[model samples]
Target chain A: MKLDSAGLEILSGGECLNLLASAPIGRIVFTDRALPAVQPVNFCLLDGNIVIRTAPGSKLAAAARNAVVAFEADDFDATFRTGWSVTAVGHARAVSEPEEIARLSALPLTPWVPGTHDHFIVMAPEQISGRRLSR
Target chain B: MKLDSAGLEILSGGECLNLLASAPIGRIVFTDRALPAVQPVNFCLLDGNIVIRTAPGSKLAAAARNAVVAFEADDFDATFRTGWSVTAVGHARAVSEPEEIARLSALPLTPWVPGTHDHFIVMAPEQISGRRLSR
Candidate 1:
């Protein structure tokens, strides 16, 4: 909970989750061909896990299955030079159960990509950390 | 370039670099402690490479030196359910020479965090790809 020299406030775990819940778009980071790859995706918070819908055979769906990943979201005002960023580190698991997938699809977690989003990847936040830069 | 089912247009390499130059913020994904980690950073494009300033002892600075990383930036309209995302994948190198660092510091690549950002990391975009979702 220490503030950095630039007045960056380290947010608690609860605050980190709250900030994450406030954003709908985030970047999911995973290993691709032994190198890091990232892409922006629309997601929702379901039962403390970040849920994202992807199409089968997609790079994200392929790389994220049962893999350690990171999700990051933030809102920064370039003019004001202030913003808060929250990052969630966890392991992503594909939702294979039909009943659970159906239940999750009923939520507001709609994919921005136009197509069948039959695959669901859920990342349970194992480590949540956030920092807010302010005056 | 191929279009997805939902009208997602695959952008060319030149176009991806153009989109990247239009933004000032992006997420840097790197491996930390043998796991993937992501953090939002302020950067600029210089001579076809992504340049960022970081504190000397920051985790990003430590992990990014001579490491393969991914930098992603995007702009999406939730209301319209459309937007474009561009990602740059390359190896990051620390700018150790004082002359280059001084010259780069004169650019608009100011560090958002409050502190001495003497360490400069530059990533030459080896693989650039972008997708634009539109009707």
Candidate 2:
């Protein structure tokens, strides 16, 4: 395993994707009012793309329209300080076509909140990286 | 319990701070190379300011210098779809004064990774808001 300058193990592309696929919740970072804002979201990986189901006309859905955003997920044991973090930088675009939405609707995408979350935002990562730290 | 248009309970300032005080870790949103990025950092509340200890010359340390960044913390039962999220938008400034740094070093803020984490960044929230979602 290759180690970064920070002593954390650098995860390969496959390792990063596998780790991302295992986590149920992740954080999405976007420019809100010209400042950085983060919102925790439950997301899933579909066809190697990060897919998010959010409420229509929501802040996230509006800000994520064809914009470059960052997605991060991790599982860390605060007690032991041993964990892995995966971050994907991508262009987030809303899926408006019916055929495309229909295909994504078949996925296991479920929102934690009880609301109308028909808007689908798919992010195809341009850069994916992660690191693993051992206690 | 006051509810927003989305039906989530709007938490008061006291409630927000109490919830933030209970979390061991949170995600810091800051602009990186002209794009938004999120990194999970273990933090603590000091005099109602969000304090984080990180490597001296780290990316987070550099980007967070005297900038308006957003900090978010939450505790959620993903399975039951219940949780609360608190977000604080504030200006992040590096604590350079020896006496100030010395005081912050005394806090319970401990970095998850082992290293020389003497640099301190304190964010005094200008706008703090949060909401709780029920199962």
- Whose TM-score is greatest here? 2
Q: How well is each residue in B1-135 modelled by candidate 1, as lDDT tens digits?
A: 599654589998888889988886888999999988988888889999999888888889999989999999988888887889998899999999989988998998777776788889999988888999874
lDDT of each: 0.88, 0.89
Tens digits of per-residue lDDT, candidate 2, B41-130, equal 889898899999999999999999999999988877777878999999999999999999999999988777766899999999988989
Interface RMSD of the candidates, in order: 1.7, 1.4
Candidate 1's DockQ: 0.72
Candidate with maximal DockQ = 1
lDDT of 1 by residue, A18-114 (tens): 8888887988999988989998888999888999999988989999999999999998888888899998899999999999989988988877766
For model 1, what is the C-alpha lDDT against the true structure? Answer: 0.88
TM-score of 1: 0.95
TM-score of each: 0.95, 0.96
Alpha-carbon runs more than 4 Å astray in model 1: A5-7
